[model samples]
Target: MDTQKLTIRLPESDVQFIKRFAEEHKTTVTEMIRRYLKQLQAQHIDEADAALQSITGLLPQNITEADTRRLYADYMMDKHR
Candidate 1:
């Protein structure tokens, strides 16, 4: 995949820590940061999936199409008000 260059600024202490940790693992700081970000993204996906499961448990098991429409309309109206 194509990627663009990006620059960021962080504390000197944080940079030193990342550099040392990356050296220990034999990788660059950029790669370490990317891996950390991917792990966080996976964690967020897991949390969102759990929330969806909880919502499914709260909703009826056999909602008809009309019931779905009414529920959507009610939710929208309540949210707007």
Candidate 2:
């Protein structure tokens, strides 16, 4: 796969921390950043899956508009409580 260069500006202290962390893990700062970004993407996917699962079959098959509104209101109230 092809890759492109990214230039980022960070505080000196943060740069030092990243350098120290890379040395301790025997990895480059670029690799650490890539791993962190992949981890974040995985976490976002997991959260989306959870949200979809939470709403699965939430409404009844024959629910009317009024019933849907009432159900939504109740759900919101219960969530706040």
Candidate 3:
């Protein structure tokens, strides 16, 4: 994978601990941080998908275009009130 250099500052003690942890775990500090960020990205995608599904499930199975427009118009009217 393509990678770029990123610089971050941490307390000396924290940095030392991370180095020890990485050595014991057979990985690097950069790898651990990358995995953590990937987890957050995955969770965000899952949450977004769930939100979309909930909205889609609210509508009828055979709703027509006219019905959709009417519903949207009603929602807009209520929102402005």
Candidate 4:
């Protein structure tokens, strides 16, 4: 995967803690942060999917994506007329 360097400032204590933890875990700090950020990203995507699923019941079972698109197009045309 492509990677970019990021720079950040932290308290000396936090920096030391990360170093100590990384040594104990036999992993680099970069890998630790990568796992943390990936989990946050996954949570965001799961939340978005849940939001869409929650709204599905509000629409008619017989309606489809094409029907929704056509209806939205008609509404926009009327709105601008």
Q: Which numbered prediction scores highest in lDDT against the true structure?
A: 4
lDDT tens readout by residue for model 3, 31-69? 999999999999999999999988986878999999999
RMSD of 4: 4.4
**Tens-digit per-residue lDDT, 12-77, candidate 1:** 999899899899989998787788999999999999999988887676789888999999999999
- For each candidate in turn, give its C-alpha RMSD to the true structure in angstroms: 4.2, 5.3, 2.2, 4.4
TM-score of 3: 0.76
Q: Residue 36: error of model 1 in Å?
A: 0.7
How well does each candidate superpose onto the true structure, as a TM-score? 0.69, 0.69, 0.76, 0.73
* Candidate 3, superposed: residue stretches over 4 Å from native: 75-81
| Poorly placed runs, candidate 2 (over 4 Å) | 60-81
lDDT of each: 0.90, 0.95, 0.95, 0.96
- Summarize candidate 2's per-residue lDDT along 1-81 as a digit string, tens digits: 687899999999999999999999899999999999999999999999999999988877889999989988999999999
Count of backbone clashes for each model?
0, 0, 0, 0
Ranking by TM-score: 3, 4, 2, 1
Minimal lDDT window, size 10, model 2: 54-63
